[model samples]
Target: MDVDTDIDKHFQQLQDQKRMLLMAKSRKGEVPRDRKPPQVAYHQFMMSHMFRAGLAQSNENMIRSAFVPPAYQPCTTPIMKLQPIKINQLQLETHHRGRYIVLKVMTPPMRMTGILALGADANGDIVLLHMYNQEEENVREATDIVDVGMIVLVKEPYYKLTASKDYALRVDHLSDMVRLNEDDTMIPPQWMSRISEIHDSFEPHKAKADASMKKEKWWKAIRDYTAAIELGPPPDRLEIIKRNRALAYLKTKQYDAALADTGWPGFGPQPAEKALFRAAEALYHLRRFSESVAVLETLHATFPDNAQATFNLERAQKRHTEEETGCYDFKALQREAEHICPPHLDHATYIGPIKMKETAYKGRGLFVTKRVKAGDLLLCEKAFALAYVPERDEERSAGNGDITLLINIETEKGFMGGQADLIRIIAQKMYLNPSVAPAFTSLYHGDYGATPITFVDGNPVVDTFLIERTMALNVFGCPNSSLATHKRAMNNESMVDNVYHSCGIWPQASLINHSCTCSARRSFIGDMMVVRATRDLEPGDEVTFWYQIPHFKANMRDKLKGWGFVCDCALCQDAKQTKATVKKERTKLRAALTEKCNSPVPSHKAMERLIDKLEATYAVSPDLVPRLGHWDAQMQVARIYAAKGNMDQAFKSACKVLVFLGFSLDDSKKGFEIKKWGMVLDYLIDAFMFIGSALIELKALASAKKAYQYAKTVYRIVVGEDETFEKTYEDHVF
Candidate 1:
């Protein structure tokens, strides 16, 4: 029953009303007068609070009797009484919505005498009184003078929805003249202050502030803006202010500031072709290629016939492409992403090798349910979704292959900064399953990749609700994930990461949660992961993968909390605990490793013992294991082999550990999977390119050539130079 509690409950009801608005289709279904319900709710909650605060029934009755104005009684019976309130001191006005106000009665013969006034109770019955503020002889004669200082007395209840108390009172026939004393007239300062405050907070004040800079009172005007801003005006008002500020900035020659303020957030009628076109021009002149491209992109979408937007977009794209190059090496890219290519696709369940769905999406391989080995043949997938982002420069690039695979075109296409239509068309093609409710409408770019599509001609129907339940059952970023990032063709900045990493459908593969140390490994059979046991797995163990960028410490992990749902799996559960007990043991091992490396006499025994202890420490809590810890330990072992002059042993350990590391979705490889034979083929291409540099470092070419030839052969097998594959290959390889 506290005022704050009352306010809070009412606020919640208001919020609920707003939320229900989205599902409402008609005006009748709309929330009934926003102000009324909350006000009533607040009043009720306040009463509850009052009762809880120990105001007993008798006490409340007495308070109500004392507080309730006498005129509020529900009755139309006429009564004669001395009018205590003056009308002259009070001014009243009404707002657009229905609410009433009246000045509290303060002195006898209050303002405006000889007025018949009515007051109403909850039932709207009127109370009437007849009185005059002045002498009866003077009141009737001064019909033309409704002076400000005069007092009027009235009897009876009146009901009306209006803010002005004085306006609700009307002068009716009192034939006798009314004599009034100036000392008896009333003027209400409180009523004037209320009107002044409301006016101060109105839109006109905002317009005044916006007009201030032109009048050269910028500082004073901006200071006045605080009140108007606190009581936020409509978007149109803000736009006008922003536009004015932009012009003011332009006059000062602060072009960038002007442009920034003039854009959508500041002064946008964004879809307006002229506004966007001009903004695009400004961005281009400023050489802000990305921003210019964005403006042009919006303009083009709004009015496709606008040649200027099209031209500007092309121009901006060209500039962007030219300026942005060498950020990544394609050969290295293949190596990094090689893990997406499994040795052989496990399609033991292939049903007649489903062909491509549409001619537009050519050579995209079909669904073949066969279990391919790590190095077995999976059907060659082509592009089922194609997007050509025209750029002025030929050097323009994309993060993934141009065409991506999909389980359902409608559901799987990501929402990123490019080619929204590409995603839209695919989403429209999704099968409508009644049971499948949408998990999220916004697509995060990281959620999908060029994963393999299962069906070509036929749509692979999936229960979206099932997917939602799966995501819920599994730990995702938010505990309640109605915002699954994969449902929409595009989302703004919010859903980018999820969509960007989204590859083809590994329906089963997607079930594995992330872990720092994963037992199961994902290798692209063709478009999907042929998930296999990288290490021996016991039955009944939950499969997991590292949800985070591996190799990061606990602090880094903490920083990424909201990126997705909080993981409550075994590994994450272990990570949440303190490592106080294990710290000492880890420190001791590290010291030993350093001491053995630095000593005048190398102690092999000491190093081996230290490594053993480190392993023991790691085994104590599998959940406590940091991703990089194991890989670093492996490297130490490899180093020991290298130092002992065991070249074969050292090389073998290095290759084994590096290969495993390469498969990791960690900071080093950025989440690009690098496992399986076909992946090795892709990796070898990079190995061939980079091995020469390493070969010179190690003074070995024979080993490097062997690695290169091995990669070349796999490429020849998996990526055959068929024209159909080649035609769609460029866009489908990322």
Candidate 2:
């Protein structure tokens, strides 16, 4: 018969034998004396017949010849026949002079973040290979090219010698290693014959022994099962082995790998019921609750009487609904302020209302394409990477040797400079997520020239100087608010003191230029920074925010030193032309206002004089006097009126305080929710309470109740469900 006809006949005979054995077992009411199943026996019988016929030299070769087409081989080059030395022969005495070696992998590749892997050859010789290149594109390509149990040809291999004298072959370039498939014609016949013997004799016995010892020695069981699977066991046995490996993977917290073993296509037949249940459990641990629920639903449909499947299905469904609605407590991220804030608050990152553009004077600036009003959210940014600056006392008192040693090592490696710890953290983040490297490289690195170097794959290096300079010009120092500070206390003692500052890079927000008279003010709610318009802005307006405190006594020169720029903004330019006059006037006005504010019982006339002095000083140069002082002056006037029992004047003054702090009387005009206010929240809440008390004294009961309710809402947002403030306000109003 022709080859095709003969193969079909062989398969038909095996099927017939399997059917007869299964029938005999059913009649006898147990597996006939031998413990082997019909499917396993049939596979072994077919393999033995092929070996005796000599149509192919080994069972693996025979199976490949029957299934794989000659024209569809993985590699089609005659150069593959250039015989390579075995991995066992790769020693420093003979092969260290850059000789090539060919190896068939025996164990699963141990990958370290997709950059490097430790692989074992057929003879159990381990070698280290670097899998990434200098460019991020090349690094991603290398990760996709390598896998476990593939035959590979390495060229010009070198040894990396260590203190213990244990050496490994290193392959650096993508061209140095070539992956080969089992069906390739250039495979050496002797190696194939030995592999077949090892598979039949050693692998089956090893699998049985490992399965027996699985309960007490699960880690070893997983290793042995992986080896057996790589050796090409019989089809029925392969399914059983994969299921066993999946269970061990789940126990070890390797959820992704466990899911792959149970559900990956072409590994073997469909996994049995037990394996499917294990896959659902794996998905649940990975926090993919929706997928876990779906898998459990399928299991319940197939086996309606399964009590465990029903219980798990209900649990997964409930968790999936909670995750979709953001109802969980977020317990894992309580200490991390950046993670405590929900991503949905940052609309500018996900929503497109503004774009960055290049300017002649400013390197880059953010411009608004849509019209925005006062109290509108112009931008909300989440940090790309963040690191906390430890308090001076905490650093000196730290007891962990590993942390101290790491700092010393970094200093020796030349990462020590201004903000070196922050630079190191950002560099490590870029290395771990290569896709973000391109955006990071595009950021403006201050006036320093490029420092390029040759690439080494295994020991990848980042430019620390460039990272430090970029961060110096761009990072925002965010203060932890009272709300975030209280939440952070649930996780660690290090963050209990709210005085520590956390620094981070908001890549898009960095484009906004500095302005003393900024149109927008920035506030932090956890790690989320919300930028709202302090005044109405038209389309095409350059969106700007304050880089430093606007009311500080320092001149523009001192404030702009770290930024490496001159004072060119309208306020700075005005101050520059009349520096002496502006400085003298600001000092006089501030001194007068401070004295009046500190009085035990200030008169209404003195408060009115303070407001007039602030208005006149603002007229000279608005930037010289910050807007925060104006709000403080208005609050003082309101307190003076309330103290004198002048309810009408107190209500008007409180309303002005709210407006100056970026609150709108018309609720429809406000862009941001009241809960998003940062440091100003406490002041805003107090102003509302004052307004409510004044209206009550005036006998406007309905208006008074509305104002009190708004105050309660803001208080609830800041302190969560604790109702101490709400109860006190209600009792006072009643």
Measured by lDDT, the strongest candidate is 2
Residue 478 alpha-carbon offset, candidate 1, angstroms: 22
Clashes per candidate (backbone, < 3 Å): 108, 0
The global Cα lDDT (0 to 1) of model 1 is: 0.35
Candidate 2 per-residue C-alpha lDDT over 1-734 given as tens digits, one digit per residue, 9 for 90 to 100: 00001123244534444454344334432212322343453344345445444632332211101110001101112343344555545543122333456665433333222234445444554555443222222222333345555566665554333112234454433334555544344455545665443333436645554664545455456656766776788877777777877887776556766787786432235447877788898877665678888888878988889899999898888667554543323222223444543221211132225678887787888887888654556664556666444333454235211111011111122111113334545665554333455566677655566334312322223454456557657777655433444334423445433333355677877888877666666655455555665556678788777676444355766866667776576556655665577658767776787787788866667867766775665544332323455677778889888988887888878876665554545322112123212223435556767887887788777777667766655544343222345443444552
Query: What is the C-alpha lDDT profile of model 1 across 1-734, one tens digit per residue?
Result: 00000123234433443333322322321222222232453344345445533633232221000000111111122122223322222222211111122232211222222322232222222222222221222212222223222333333213221211112332221211122222222323433343333453547666676677667654335434544545676777655554555454444333454465555433333444555665666565444668778878877887999886787788777656533531212232233333332212211221111222212221111222333333222222222222232221231232222322111112321122122222322232232211111322212224332213322213232222222223222222210011111112113324323212222222233334444454433322223222333332333444444444443245435634534445454345545563868756666667667777677766546665665676576543332343233444445555566677764455444454444343322112122223333112223333333332233335465554444443343333333211122232233221
What is the C-alpha local distance difference test score of each model? 0.35, 0.53
Judge candidate 2 at residue 641 and give its lDDT.
Answer: 88
User: On a 0 to 100 scale, what is the lDDT of residue 411 in model 1?
Assistant: 32
